[model samples]
Target: MTAQPNSTEARDMAYHLHSYTNPRKLEREGPLIIDRGEGIHVFDNSGKRYIEGMAGLWSVAVGFGEKRLVEAARRQMDKLPYYHTFSQKAHGPVVDLAEKLIGMAPVPMSKVYFANSGSEANDSAIKLVWYRSNALGRPEKKKIISRIKGYHGVTALSASLTGLPNNHRSFDLPLANILHTTCPHYRTGAEPGQDELAFSRCCAEELEALILEEGPETIAAFIGEPVMGAGGVIVPPEGYWAAIQDVLRKYDILLIADEVICGFGRTGNMFGSETFGMRPDIMTLSKQLSSSYQPIAALMINDSVYEPIANEADRIGALGHGFTASGHPVAAAVSLENLAIIEEKDLVGNVRRLAPHFLGRLNALERHPLAVEARGIGLIGALELEAADGAAAGATGARVGAILQRNGLICRNIGDSIAFCPPMIITAAEIDEMFDIVEASLGELGQQAAA
Candidate 1:
């Protein structure tokens, strides 16, 4: 038998495999091993503090170590630790949460379905679209369309729906029926002298063209994030969503707003769909729903989408789709408590008040030599680093990201862009501190690139 490892690094290397990590590099460097978190910062096992600029994977809205969330989990665990929302079984937390989500939905929603993660919620949405199409008697309407830079999730069908190449490579993903539309990013899509409105029209035309090429009868849904989150926080160009939704409506394509990142005050609203005027037929939500205190996700369906499915389930005598932990009592209880805290603390109002400050700080970086573009909404933002005269697309991005990490601000390096998504609970002083660190890092990187 092999001997057990003693060091944290050794144990992690022996047993842990991390997602989105370079396996070979992890074997060499091991994990940072975060010990705990408070507010918008996390401490490594060595006591090194990092301003969690990405909000613990774009969630953690209320920040870390909220006693209310902890107490809520403990209360539920004591009262009813485990209960499934399957086979006609239900629990108070689940029922209450469903009501709360429906009431809070930007658009009118008929029901809520619980899942374990954003990926699961997205996967369920895909299944629901297919089932809805089948119920409408158009079995051919199964293909789903997403944009090139949009991020849905990472499950089988959801990963297929994801527009990024890396998510699809080596995974045999984007399964069979998933189609992609043009990314509505003007900076990348623009030709010389192309106006934003023209770019918007171009995107609409491209989507319409794709739908025509695929045949509208074969397309079931169109899914997208309100602001492209993992895809470098790319906000849509002027009139982008308006035009895209027009095309989808014309073709009768169901819209699925993947609000996993943009939901829950991340975009200065309760939901991104509201901020962006995206009237989706269905919505997938996670992340801030429980402030990442516990694992939970939800799918909100409109009456147009849910009634058929409910009827089909009644006719078929079984739904046959659900995780054992779906709507787990402990998670639902924590999520309910999290929502209450968000409302009581007026976190959404805080986001609206602080967003201009955050955006001002990020926009200030535009004049920095290495910064090509600085864009964001609410607390979520990105600074795209310009490549050296002839350097590769992501070369400077890697250097800037390393510099930021060393400077104690941990942000996401998505290609040539650095993404920032501070917790909704971030104070004005902490916001200033975060920008100061980022500015220092950018200055150092700019000097290095110039040299």
Candidate 2:
């Protein structure tokens, strides 16, 4: 059906250029204009509600229409609408939020630097790594290694750090110094007959090989998501992080845990780093930090990563790296309140409680014919799709996504994987309902195929 003239969809087709969309198809089909949100549900313009299976992009820890966050923003905006952290100027909200993040860190952290989004936070982190390298007089130690299919962000530098091809294709990205090694998906990356342990060791060996090929003295850092999010929710095989960390230690390389999706109770723990045995020197956080209520992201550095940079800055008289909205008081305020709600309500506990049900339902999908594999941890998971009757690679997933949308669930299709990351506030009953829709959607696909 075509969009009515001057309608919201029509205007969107006429004016808006969406990200990650096929523009031509959007012009023909228009958009699903979300009107408002409450709890784990969002209503479209025509008042159709969706379960928000992806948590508004794998964030929104405390759920939507959270009144406390609104109140926090209002109070801070009224008291101090805007402030910059430049020239040693600081505000209460930013200071409090930073302190809160540092105190809540999975490992010891020295300082928290704020940014408006994950992209900027990663970009800033890379710059800091380069800065730290320069400060330590190891200017050649600047190449940062990420993993294949890892999702960092979309900025020039961060996009390069990201391991996805589309993120780099035609964007002239990956600049210089950003490299990608092996992805640790046992089913996808391992050779035939390779067990999880062997594959895990192979991943580490490949990483070390890459480091040696690049000259280990030149490798500055290795960055990764604790549980790969956009890369089809690929949970690392057993002993994966331990093996990887061993390599980094041998080379004295820093680890940058991109906790944008795995932070803030999404992964059954406060941070994915705790869930996995990752000892990162620097960490980039966003998405759930403020639950996308207000745009905010932060980077935390341990003393091992910060001291040399601090000394270097002291010698040079400045760090000279930051974003204008680094710690916007209102954003920081909402984030602080968001964290309070997560703790006071024991959202992490909720995740731990419901994760078995969530994963049970997710893993059960493997019984379906179209399911190639099922993977996940905590509250995040995905059912990978195999094309029916030799259809295109992602065709099955695309069809499943459309069916789930019509069935009142909004989830994301990353490549051929149908990801379900509902809000942490979701109940056990809600988990059943969410999977009911998913199961029915896949069943419908089967029915259509059989017919």
Candidate 3:
């Protein structure tokens, strides 16, 4: 039903232009303005509670209404509301968070550069890659390779790094010196009779072939999500990362793990790099960094990647890179508290314990008539829908997702897949409850499709 032209809906339609949304549809149907949240659930303007299955854009790891995060923000606000880390100036929160992140890194990291969002962090990483290569007197080594369907971020450079066509179609994106490799989804991209391991080799060969075709000297880095999140929560085929990393290492290309969604125990590890054996030269983190309570993101670079940039900065007399709120004190404080809560509550261990039930319930959805496959790891999962007869791709999944939304379960539909990544704090019973709604919604969708 189209929402009535009430104050909230009317104002939203009047003043807001939402990202990744069809504005025409928003004009007709309006928005679900959430009023509040508790735990993993949010209440709409009408006070109807729904499970935030996607965890508010795949962040919110510690869950909603987390008092510790709130109090942390408040305490920081009271102490030092805002401070900038530029021109050698630093604050306690920023310094402390950096130290904590460095110590907890999956691989040894030299420094942390803070940004306000995932997009900025990724865009900055690209710039850093270019800067580093130039500093090393390899200015031609500027091209970057990302996989098809990889979701990096939406800023200019970051969106170019993103492989989704929709993000680039009208934006004149993928600006230049950017190349794409084949998606690592073995289920759909593999050759007939080829196994996953073999397909992984094929993917690596494709990367190597691309590097050769483009001239290895021109390619500076390869960035990828540890588990592709917005791109249907794709877990790469077995041996995929190892093979791909081998090729990158051979070409002397830097590897960047974009752990924006898969970080903070989402993949049952501190970072997705650990979940999958990726020793990235650089890493981008966001989403759960501050639990989305305050916008924050960061990039960590290993010594090899950092040294050139540091030298370049020394040579140039200034780094010439940073945001005004690069390391805002409040965001850093909130992030520190979020990590501490995760530690105190053993949230990572909880995700490990609860993942089996989560994945089991998710995999069981494959039996649904409309489901083509159910794929998941840790707390993240997706149900790829079978296209209805004579319908376009993603039509059935979108329809079913809309039905699920109406039934009070919020998830995201990417192409034909509906993704679910609840907060790490979710309980086993809540996992079951979330899937109960999913089963009911899918069953209804099946009946509707048949009808």
Best-matching candidate per lDDT: 2
The weakest ten consecutive residues by lDDT in model 3 span 1-10
Whole-model lDDT, model 1: 0.91
- Native-to-model Cα distance after best TM-score fit, residue 126 in candidate 2, in Å: 0.7
lDDT tens readout by residue for model 2, 1-451:
9755788888888888898899998987779999999999999999999999999999988889999999999999899999999999999999999999999999999999999999898899999999999999998999999999999999999999999989999999889999999999999788999999999999999999999999999999999999999988999999999999999999999999999999998888999999998989999999999999999999999998889999999999988988888899999999999999999999999999999999999999999888889999999999998876777878888999999999999999997899988989999999999999999998998899888
Candidate 2 steric clashes: 0
Candidate 1 lDDT over residue span 1-451, tens digit each:
9789999998988888889888888998778789999989999999999999999999999999999999999999899999998778999999999999999999899999999999999999999889888888899999999889788888888889889998999999879999998887789898899999889999999999999999999999999999999888989988889999999999999999999999999999999998889999999999999988889999999999988888888888987689999998999999999999889999999999999999999999999877889989988999998887788877788778888888899898998999999999998999999999999998897677668
Residue runs of model 3 more than 4 Å from their true location after superposition: 1-6
lDDT of 2: 0.93
Which candidate, 1 or 2, would have the higher lDDT against the true structure? 2
Better of 1 and 3 by lDDT: 3
RMSD of each: 1.4, 2.0, 2.2
Lowest-lDDT window of 10 residues in candidate 2?
387-396
Q: lDDT by residue for model 3 over 1-451, one digit each (tens)?
A: 8656659889899889999999999999988899999999999989999999999999999899999999999999999998898889999999999999999999999999999999999999999999999999999999999989999999888899899989999899989888999899978999999999999999999899999999999999999999999889899989999999999999899999999999989989989999999999999999899999999999999999899999999999999999999989999999999999989999989989999999999999899877888998999999999888899988887898898888989999998899999988999999989899999998898788669
| Clash counts for the predictions, in order | 1, 0, 0
